[model samples]
Target: MIPALFDRRLIARRRRRAVAAAVPGSDFLVEHVAADLADRLAAVTRRFGTAAAIGGPTDALARTVTASGRAERVIRADVFAAGPAGDHPVDVVIDDERLPFADGSLDLAVSGLALQWVDDLPGALVQIRRALRPDGLFVATFVGGDSLTELRAALLAAESERKGGASPRVAPFVDVRDLGGLMQRAGFALPVTDVDRVTLRYATPFHLMRDLQAMGASNPLRERARGLTPPSLLARAAEIYAETAADPDGRVRASLTLVSLSGWVPHESQQKPLKPGSARTRLADALGAVEHKGE
Candidate 1:
């Protein structure tokens, strides 16, 4: 049997807590990701009548898409209900693994940074594809494998030194190379993937950890160390991080590599790959070079 990668119940509870915390400016990454998705959507000349922002921690995706004028209506879906005060409300509650959208219900579907925590990413992508109409677009951005590299290294080194063994502290992320194949496997046409690395400077590692908690991005791995993390281990990790990854100004660098993905549901009207040997012009002729005979 395939082991569960993440604890969904824990993720939901943490997200709710994060909303309740109402930390100001904690949604910066989500906002950035949402704006990127909107910009990409705006690049497409077509307008979407219905769009769903799935599993977003905040309503940034919905708001950005609406502001971009790419979607006539944007529905925000999340695992949590409306926040108590000073927080965005979700229009629909959904599990990313089991999207409730009916087939062909959406002209556009987007997500921002939330899919990284999903246990079954390929299944989620399939559901998103199935929810879109023919030729409908899907755009999403999530943290790639290169994200949090410094933190992961520091944590591992500290754990190994202090405890003589290291456990799974940071959750695993998907590599950028594998995403395009996964999109094709999920039956999306014209699949495309790209990466944008955003680096944030923190005064100290603790501040970065606090931001992660506020973002509801703390470890949700099923094999995560149970009980509280030891304070000394964290201290050592911070020291190691400062020693290894600090900038010239003494602030630490934390990287968030956002992997942007775009795909479309299959449609006959869309561009298709030419059949083998169908081209009229030879490669050498197109390049104005003499062709060489194969031995």
Candidate 2:
């Protein structure tokens, strides 16, 4: 069996704490992703009878879907309740690894900044595909690619210098290239994947760390170093971060690569790729060029 990469319990605890604290501006990414999801849903002309918003840190996703009038009903599901909900309350507490929905029940499923934490991402995607009705659409965005590269570098260098060794501080993120294949592996038809890069500037490295903690996005890797990070290590990391990642304005840049994935449940009516060697027109004829034969 494949081992878990993240500590689920710790993730839940951190998320719950964030919700309870209600840190101001901590959910900026959630809001940004919610807006992006809304825009994507708006592009679709057809309305969905039922939809599920999975793993949203806030009710932002559900609210956005509801407000779009694209989905008649939106079921909000998360690992932990993100405090009292807004227009749509938390319908089910769920682990991304296991969904509770019945097969072929949902017309749409949307998630924002959540699937990256799932241990079995492919399995979770399979479950999502199974839960969707024929031709049902799935759209999601997650942190991926070279996210937090500067922080990872700074932490590693600092820890190595101060403690003689370094441990994993930032969680590993998926590369954009692999997402489309994952969608195909999960049996989704017409799968599409793209990346959206967002760069945030911070006055200092410590500020960035505090913001991550507020967002419950701190390291949750199972192999992460135990116990609190040393103050001296942290200080050194801050120094290194400023020195290496700072711009002319003296603020450091942090990169966030949001990988967007969209696919549809297979249906007989959906378009399919033409079989190999089935084309009526030759490529040479279409291109107005002669075909060459190799000896």
- Most accurate candidate by TM-score: 1
- Per-residue error at 109 for model 2, in Å? 0.4
For each candidate, give its TM-score against the true structure: 0.96, 0.94
10 residues in a row with least lDDT, candidate 2: 80-89
Q: What is the lDDT of candidate 2?
A: 0.91
For model 1, the superposed segments whose C-alpha errors exceed 4 Å read: none
Name model 2 segments beyond 4 Å from true.
Answer: 82-88, 290-295
For candidate 1, which ten residues in a row score worst on lDDT?
A: 79-88
Model 1: how far is 229 from its true place, Å? 1.7
User: Tens digits of per-residue lDDT for model 2 on 6-121?
Assistant: 99999988988877778889999999999999889889988999999998678899899999999889898988764555422488988778899999999999999898898888
